[model samples]
Target: MEKSGENYKVISCGDVASLGRVVLHDALALTGAEVSINELPAGVSVPFVHAHKNNEEVYVVLSGKGFLFIDGEEFAIQEGDAFRIDPKGERCMKADDTSAIRFICVQAKANSLEGFTQSDGVLSETKPSWL
Candidate 1:
């Protein structure tokens, strides 16, 4: 599907992987807010402990068991579990050993890499920084 103002595309899990498709990517609002729907395969991790200078994000678990590591703290998450992180905090997540973790990640205000950098002085998103 297409939308006005900015680019809007329907990406599946299959697009991100192979089996499932229609997942959303790079859907950043004019306000710099970004939204994405991700469908993780049976075993996948959400990536590394990256921090955003001015973007607070929330993760809502949709299916399967979930595991999240925020600033070195580990957590056991399940269906209906929601994890929220503030800007400048190091965070990352992973899927359970037996099942995949499907979740929607939402970022408000500082969605763009530029905006995030402007919010704080950071060279890269992968590096550790404080807000």
Candidate 2:
């Protein structure tokens, strides 16, 4: 949903950072998946390792650096890095005292894909099909 002249909702990263251990969800309306902005202060991590029973999550790092521990493996992640984990995997994140971390986490049920076809490849009704 647009607000006034804007085409989409916007949330300030600076505004969110002030609140520690915060994850902002449903900031924008959507049909297929849920989204959240996750922030962690230095030396703190999401308190528990989580494994979702019905949804898979993709984490996109927006800033800072951290270790993403999934099961028993640790992967270093920094800005612009993105990773997806299955519903059965145990995962969590941690940021050291050196810097804070912010990221976008999007979740949806596994194997669910939503799409629409405006045109079909070989049909006249599909004119301008490649648009």
Candidate 3:
């Protein structure tokens, strides 16, 4: 839970496997949406390349270098960059050279542990096996 008198949650960042030190600034509860700030090191990649059935997302780079893959199309991204992905828009990202990449991630709605899935390069909604 977040502390009072604050609208942000500062998530401690560090080496997450291949991903380097990164902070997850979660603002989902505050904004009533899935909005977050992430500080990623270079040579790191996000967890998956999937989409949300009932949520939309966006990423804005604060620093470092990387590429944004949206629907299989790659685009060069750098500091002070922004991109938005609609609901169920396939997406993923990878940092280059352990470059410090700070970006904002927003989700329209929170999924109950069962995030969307990708099958045969296609995204679809499914129940989480753990549920």
Model 1 residue 86 distance off true place after TM-score fit, in angstroms? 0.5
User: Over the full model, what C-alpha lDDT does candidate 1 score relative to the true structure?
Assistant: 0.68
Stretches of candidate 1 off by over 4 Å are: 1-32, 110-131
* Candidate 3 Cα RMSD (Å): 13.9
Candidate 2, residues 8-45, lDDT tens digits: the string is 55555356687553344555555567777778887778
- Give one digit per residue, the lDDT tens place, for model 1 in 23-71: 2434322345556666666667765679887889888887888678888
TM-score top scorer: 2
**Model 2 residue 37 lDDT?**
76
Rank by lDDT (best first): 2, 1, 3
How many clashes does each candidate structure show, in the order listed? 9, 0, 4
lDDT of each: 0.68, 0.79, 0.66
Where does candidate 2 have its weakest 10-residue lDDT segment? 1-10
Worst 10 residues of 3 by lDDT: 20-29
Considering TM-score, which of the candidate structures 1 and 3 is the better prediction for this target?
1
| Residue pairs with backbone overlap in model 1 | 11-22, 11-23, 12-21, 12-22, 12-23, 13-20, 13-21, 14-20, 14-21
